[model samples]
Target: MTTNLILTNSLDEIAEFVTLLVIFIIVIGITYFSIRIVGNIQKEKLGRGNIQILETQKVSNTKYIQIVRIGKKCFAIAICKDSISYLCEVDEGDLQFNTDSSISKSSAESFKTIIDKFKKDKPED
Candidate 1:
């Protein structure tokens, strides 16, 4: 009967949809795990080296100032797109390190608060 044919067609379509969804989810999970594994491996390799970037500040689109630690010594360097120049040797005692984990959250909250204040003070059209 046509009724049975319609029911069978819908079931087949549903099964195909479910199969595709499952495949998509599996692919996403595999990609996520692979990325995480690669990242961990890279971090481990980088941490084993004596040269480490302690901090970096962007000066321009193609320029930056970076504080780097080479073994027991720390230096400030200017990095341009084409070259790197040594600025000066930084005294470790004068440098401040942020130990706060909620800095990003606090900064986001402050930005949101500023936006809300701006909106409140705006003139109505």
Candidate 2:
């Protein structure tokens, strides 16, 4: 009966090893899927970011001009490591930006009407 007991013990050990390996594989699969989900979430956010960079032009080495759209208006900004400055506000009629169909934008009004309103609202010096 000693040989019979030894055979039973070997089978039990093999079963335990198989169970542990299956558990390890499941853990690795869960980790990989979770990482993929997180990456997709971050990509979606950047794709629909509110502050859109329409164009950029690099001048010199570090100095660069960026045309950015903030809400309904667009502005040009000068970016550098030490300081950042707003150069001017670009009229929306001047440049057109290509956007994804997923993003919703408001209807555009006539540029002539916008200019007339700006001149009327200006305060005399």
Candidate 3:
């Protein structure tokens, strides 16, 4: 009878240990999934907070240019009679002037010179 009682007690202890382990695993899984969901939500919110500015104009008689500004970066998208060019991440300080006609070749050349000078002044990455 004493041996039977010991065996029964061992079985009960094992059952209790298994139950606790299952509960611990469920808790850890819940915590991990909750953290992942919250992280994704915050990332989406940050993405939506970004600022976008659009400017469109006719560069010349046959060419059109659209400028987009996101935060401190600027992009110039040009659509000629049959060709398209995308110039991205242009700094505002690199531009000679904030005028629509600044998209012209002469102004673009000046802007390129300014950017080159700025790059030369910065320390190497």
Candidate 4:
């Protein structure tokens, strides 16, 4: 009788642990997705602003050269921790833009290939 009671108690504890774990996972998933949705919404809202940073190249840990678009014109600017200095006005014709489809395809293919390689290299348990 004692042995049976211990076994029952152990099973109950395991079931409770599993239930809590599942709930925790669901809450985490909800939070993750909610944050992502909010981030995308905020990006869309902020992206409509007149000032846009088109490109940035790092010169040092705290200094960068950036191409910025304000209104209809684009400018190259030097950005540091303390100040921003205008470098030059950029002609619209000089800019090369990557198409969304090409960028996404390349990124997806690279990521998938990396994961496939990792899985292939890993030994099965």
Candidate 5:
């Protein structure tokens, strides 16, 4: 009878250990997945903020160009039927043009219109 009791006790201990290990593994998996979800949420928030900034700063005209500025640098991005082109910097004091030949006249006109509107709407600093 004593030998039988010892064997039963050992089996119970092993079962308890396995249960604890399984619980620990589950907890760790949940923690890892939680961190990943939170990180993705933060990245999406940052991307949305950037898009809002771009939309608010965009200028569009029917006959001329559209312009958007990324931070301090200005870009004269033109939109055509199936292509996009970057013309020249419309910012004052710097007359730089893109060396790439892919830029079209329609794009230049659109960029010029956007820059002109931005200049007009800018508040004095």
Candidate 6:
């Protein structure tokens, strides 16, 4: 009878520990999801602005061109690492894109082409 009582006490302690662990897990999950939901809600509320980016194209390593729409007019702007400049006004019909995929066919090919070009252009030592 004493052994059975000890076993029953140990089992109750283990069951209480498991229940506490489960409660802690549930609390942590709730806290994580609540924070995530609040952050997403704040981001969505802050994203309602008048200026919208329509298109972007990278010109070089440090230069890019973007078309942005402000209210009713759209303009093209050039962005560099140092400064941003207004390029020109963009009409809807003036947009053009290159359909060829030869520029970035593969990462290895692009690297190899760049190295070859540098070697060809390198001054004699």
Which has the greatest TM-score?
1
Provide backbone clash counts, one per model: 0, 0, 0, 0, 5, 0
What digit string (tens of lDDT, one per residue) describes model 1 on residues 3-117? 9999999999999999999999999999999998997897689879998777777799999888888999999999999999999999989888775632323333456677799
Report the lDDT tens digits of candidate 5 across residue range 27-80.
Answer: 999999998899789767865642211211123542234454566666666665
For residues 6-113, write the lDDT of model 4, one tens digit per residue.
999999999999999999999999999999899789778876899877766779999988888899999999999999999999997898866553332333355667
Question: Positional deviation of 35 in candidate 3, in angstroms?
Answer: 0.7
Candidate scoring better on lDDT of 1 and 5: 1
State, as a TM-score between 0 and 1, how close model 3 is to the true structure: 0.44
Candidate 4: C-alpha lDDT: 0.83
TM-score of each: 0.75, 0.46, 0.44, 0.71, 0.41, 0.47
Best model per lDDT:
1
RMSD of each: 9.0, 18.4, 18.1, 5.8, 17.5, 14.8
Model 6 lowest lDDT segment of ten: 98-107
Give the alpha carbon lDDT tens digit for every residue of 3-115 in model 3.
Answer: 99999999999999999999999999999999989978966775585444355577699897776666767888888999989866677776554545444434335567787
How do the candidates rank by lDDT, highest first? 1, 4, 6, 2, 3, 5
List the candidate 3 regions with Cα displacement exceeding 4 Å.
51-125
Weakest lDDT window of 10 consecutive positions for candidate 5:
50-59
Task: Give the Cα lDDT of each candidate.
Answer: 0.84, 0.78, 0.74, 0.83, 0.62, 0.79
> lDDT score, residue 93, model 5?
41
Best first by TM-score, ranked: 1, 4, 6, 2, 3, 5
Predicted candidate 6 versus true structure: per-residue lDDT over 1-125, tens digit per residue: 99999999999999999999999999999999999899789667746767766666789999988887787787999999999999988885676544455342333445667879999999999
Sliding window of 10 residues with minimal summed lDDT for model 4: 99-108
Name the Cα RMSD for model 5. 17.5
